[model samples]
Target: MALRKLPTHFFPSLQHQLRPFSSLNLPTLEPSNDAELVSKMLLHHHNPFHAMESSLQLHGITLTPHLLHQTLLRLKHSTKIALALFNYSKSLPSPPLTSTSFHILIDLLAKVRQFDLAWQLIVEMDQLSLSPTPTTFFILIRRLISAGLTRQAIRAFDDIQGYTQTKTNSDDFCFLLDTLCKYGYVKVATEVFNKKRDGLLPDAKMFTVLIYGWCKIGRIDMGERFLNDMIGRGIEPNVVTYNVLLNGICRRASLHPEGRFERTIRNAEKVFDEMRERGIEPDVTSFSIVLHVYSRAHKPELSLDKLRLMKEKGICPSVATYTSVVKCLCSCGSIEDAEELLSEMVRNGVTPCAATYNCFFKEYRGRKDADSALKLYKKMKEEGLFVPSMHTYNILVGIFLKLNRFGIVKEIWDDMKESGVGPDLDSYTMLIHGLCEKQKWREACQFFVEMIEKGFLPQKITFETLYKGLIQSDMLRTWRRLKKKLDEESITFGSEFQNYHLKPYRR
Candidate 1:
């Protein structure tokens, strides 16, 4: 017998159908109830199933339950798809919600704000005997809280304990409590936390969340009480736990007394030493938090000395660590040291991003040296890294406009346009102001018309610039016509414009 080739259109259609099944949001296939069709589909299935699996993997879509159920129903009840799902799930960081995949569909529906359909999916999961896990309950709990359904979220949490063996973590319980607090349900969150804390082991992570929440709500003293209780209960404080406590103290100190702040800083150092003694490594964030608090509190010299201490303790500084030092130099008007520190950053292989240049530019704000600023700008572009943001263009524009280098200003605008940055109202306004300063009233007025045609209605200041330019050039007719238009449009001319144009005529 000769083999028959399948039609070209037939294979392509099958390939297209499988390419984005989930993205296209296909309907669920009732595979278990269909047998004859299943036999026909599975007759020559190995190659087709392999092809489908490979294509779906490349597209980053899993063979969802609907996809699986249909694929299995149309073919023999084999575990090929199951095995494929396992391999794909392993490649991800978070473990796949395999047992509760149907429940997850409900979670996804909820996330997309399709609450009614999501409830239907929850009911479906119950019917299928695929119980929801704590993670599953957490999802619905968070969504309900976000939607302002505090009562519903709590009720859902109460019912979820019956669904799975996976014990709800402290964070999960705290999240519910926090939601209760947010919706004038503070007593409820407090009550729940007290009960859950008594029943479950006090996790440091959960304590950090509660303490932060309390501090945020102007209850720092209450948060401190919780902190002391956690430490007294023999639960060792982690970096986050200490950091939260320190931050709360620092915030209170800022608003209240200098003595309290100084004592807090001294106590913070003691806590740092204790963290090291207990064999808990202080991460870069831990170091940065202390440095930031000290720096903001007018203690940069101490912050710098602490950086040295951090390095001595075998804790390497991060880019944020180095950037903080450069910013401090800039703030102190030590531009030379700030520039040198930028060099140090590059040498240390902490390549400067746009933010580094932003600080550098701010230090040179009044210099307005086109040659120097443009050279630095070109160096940044040549590095083939650190694409200048909109602020960068604005700063350069201001510099050249102040220098009355209109040609250079236009060139900057051209470059900005090519970079896919359309001139904002401010950019256009700046250019028009520059034109008016040079007494090129005709060009300034034409630019104003062009800006309006480009869908940007000029601000009062923009029109004020044009009106002043005309009057200064002794083009009285043009000035009166513009004033009439302003009156018709109800645009108020401020004293700033009168001081620029009307003052000379009064003298």
Candidate 2:
């Protein structure tokens, strides 16, 4: 859809208010005095153009570039008024507008979506031989890209090359390329890079950003091509460049079958080894990515080997590093080893995050070690290193429910509320199912109502469980009321519950 053009009448009233300035014999007030008087007038007048004209006539001052720039700054909040003020200043006989003033007005116009007027001003600047600064072009290009006008932004960038005085540097090219790539316009970004590459040499960080952008969109081949191109250009790849390629390879590996996955990992490891050979020492991020790859490939032993090597190299394992290894250990049923690693992490002053604790929680639950799971939960709260996520509460609720510990289940529910963790679908499901199983109909009904009010639609199993308990407890009135509410919500009990007959009750 086309953007609606700004209304013409938006400025007519202000334009009429400034018309009387033509008749006044304005004097050449000092620039400082003119700025001071205009600033005062701006505070009282609703229309900035009106304030500027009134100040000029009263002080008998002409709008010099310095004075006009000051007035533009004062009126920067309203684009329409600023544009009117700029146009009106150009019509004055003394103290004409300068390139600096034009730059400010054009930027203001672009900001307010008045691109047509801004382009006109740029053309005017060119005709007057007023060369735009590099900063001016940079701001214009960035704003254009942000407004989803990539084509216009590219055109504006091309215009910059025509100016002999304004030299576009590496930073200027990188800024536009980065913005374009970030917004999923990689092809456009490539065009920009190609346009400026001969003049502005691409640095390592620039190559890294482009490679990362390609990797992000799952085009690993393009990323590799860029890496090779960088190498061919005699630009040595840095640690970040290799890491981006490694991450891309690992991510692609994850999507493939076992045979292809192994091949991908081998390719990634080659890059890793090559980086080390080149004396670009691996950082914590490099190690983390390798460990994650091994974890995904289901090679816990290899992950352990990497951890040992990481420690040997004096690179400390981060929370992510430990978490990756812990997850690998748990997945392969090496729960004891995982626990020892967790203990080692604590001994080394590294606090295990919520995810780290949750990893152990799942393993203990799977092994039917209820006591151990409860101990871990207590430790999580006691340490207060991290708040338990909703998943944490759901696990505890499920474990206590299976153990038939009703009081503990309620306590966990209260804890979830106190910690500001809103119960999700599974949380409500477990609570409702557990309460109904224990024949606590009143409490079950309260939670059921609360769940619906919070916009959670109970599954068919939830309806069946609640219906069975209500009928068994002979709460015919409560069952009928619940039925009416469900009917109002357009939800019907599944056919599986059709066999059960309910006693009729008066409304």
Candidate 3:
């Protein structure tokens, strides 16, 4: 069975090798004439597996599954022989799979994400009375889940449950649970876990999975109670369990840090310290939560130290950690520190998200310096960094109005339109107010008319700012015109509008 290294032109030897097959007493599969034989030899043996095998040996070649299947089928061989050929080809040391093998071929194809072909092979396996292994079903289910085919995955899981009488292992349960969590099928996962309660222990990992699912969907109390139940049942919480619980606590703290039940910050610290005492090394996620607890308590300096501690423990600072630092610095109006940290973030290949830009913009707003804020906005756009959120635009417009920087205000209004940053009603109102404040009555009136044309009827403050601006310009006729417009629009103008803007002018 030595494979001779034939010459570059190997057909003569192959023709001689296949010639004996023609005289064999095996079912004769002749291709009509010598021309057909020559054609088959050139196609299958000379050109490889597409050619018929009968003439292949004459060209110093061998039969492959692809070649054998076609030759056997042409000779009207039994289906059993086809199956045998397929199985034999599976064991070959070259070219991999046989065309006729169903199950093995499907398994191989499934491993490579060729699920459509694998499904066809499964149908073939069913025809042959071959059962798919749990691994096969699991692999297919995982693929379905990743493809976001949840309903299909559920059907597949149901199929797996029906076909097998053996108890599902922890790994299988975890896979189902994770898939359920991904698709927000927590109730289904819960029912599955509960139905198999006697056979399954609610281990720490399982509890963590369930808790995280509940927490993700804003069921913090339920998640916390579940965590306590695990603790009460003497189930030791693992790192993931504690990390998720700490996250829950931080979320509560953020929502209501100064509320009546405001001890979440202390509770988070306690959990972190307890986790450390239990020999569970706090990872960067856990450390970031602890930093949040400090930040919530208005102790940014301590949060910074925790950042240093994270580095000391070989934990890399996550984007969340960097964001928290920038937020804290901006809250304290430490713009320089915030800017330096942003530079550091860029150096470390961390691009600031919109929230980071917002934090800086908010500080600039507090500084009441429209020029600095406008420059930062231009810089953000020029760098092709994060796009400003609606809140960013709102803050910018508000600051520009406060500083009476009407030119920059006009630029913002035009920029928003050109950049497809559609502003809400508040943005329009703010622009109108900015115009009125700068005594740009004609422009303000035009903007107001545009707002009405766009179906945004003027609010009470809009008329108020316009009326006040007109009075300040000592244009009695224009004030009457605005009042008439307000009356026609049925917008209730408050006394503060008239008193604040009209009193001095009336005097």
Q: Which is the leading candidate under TM-score?
A: 2
User: What does candidate 1 score on TM?
Assistant: 0.46
Candidate 2 lDDT tens digits, 1-507: 112222121011112221211121222323465665664454345332142443344345566677787767554434545665666676667646787788777766565445666767777777777766555666577557765789989878777868536656676667677666655577778877777688777788678767866876678899999999999989999877787777777754553577876787678779878998989876777777778777777788889999999999999998878988998899788888998999899999988777787887788778878888878777767877688988788888888877777777788888886554547656787788878767789988988866653334566667767877787788878977887766553321223234344444233
lDDT of 3 by residue, 155-229 (tens): 776676555444456766676765565445666667776776578776776777677666655677878888888
Which residue pairs in candidate 1 collide? 38-74
Summarize candidate 1's per-residue lDDT along 300-335 as a digit string, tens digits.
576678788888888777666666666666666666
TM-score for model 3? Answer: 0.44
- Decreasing lDDT order of the candidates: 2, 3, 1
Model 1 per-residue lDDT at 503: 32
Would you list the C-alpha lDDT of every candidate in the order shown? Answer: 0.57, 0.69, 0.59
Clashing residue pairs in candidate 2 (N, C-alpha, C atoms within 3 angstroms): 27-60
Residue 362 lDDT (model 2): 81
lDDT of 2: 0.69
- Give the least accurate 10-residue stretch of model 1, judged by summed lDDT: 1-10
State the displacement of the C-alpha of residue 125, model 2, in Å, after optimal TM-score superposition: 37
lDDT of predicted model 1: 0.57
Residue-level error in angstroms, candidate 1, position 506: 42
Query: Between candidates 1 and 2, which one is better according to TM-score?
Result: 2
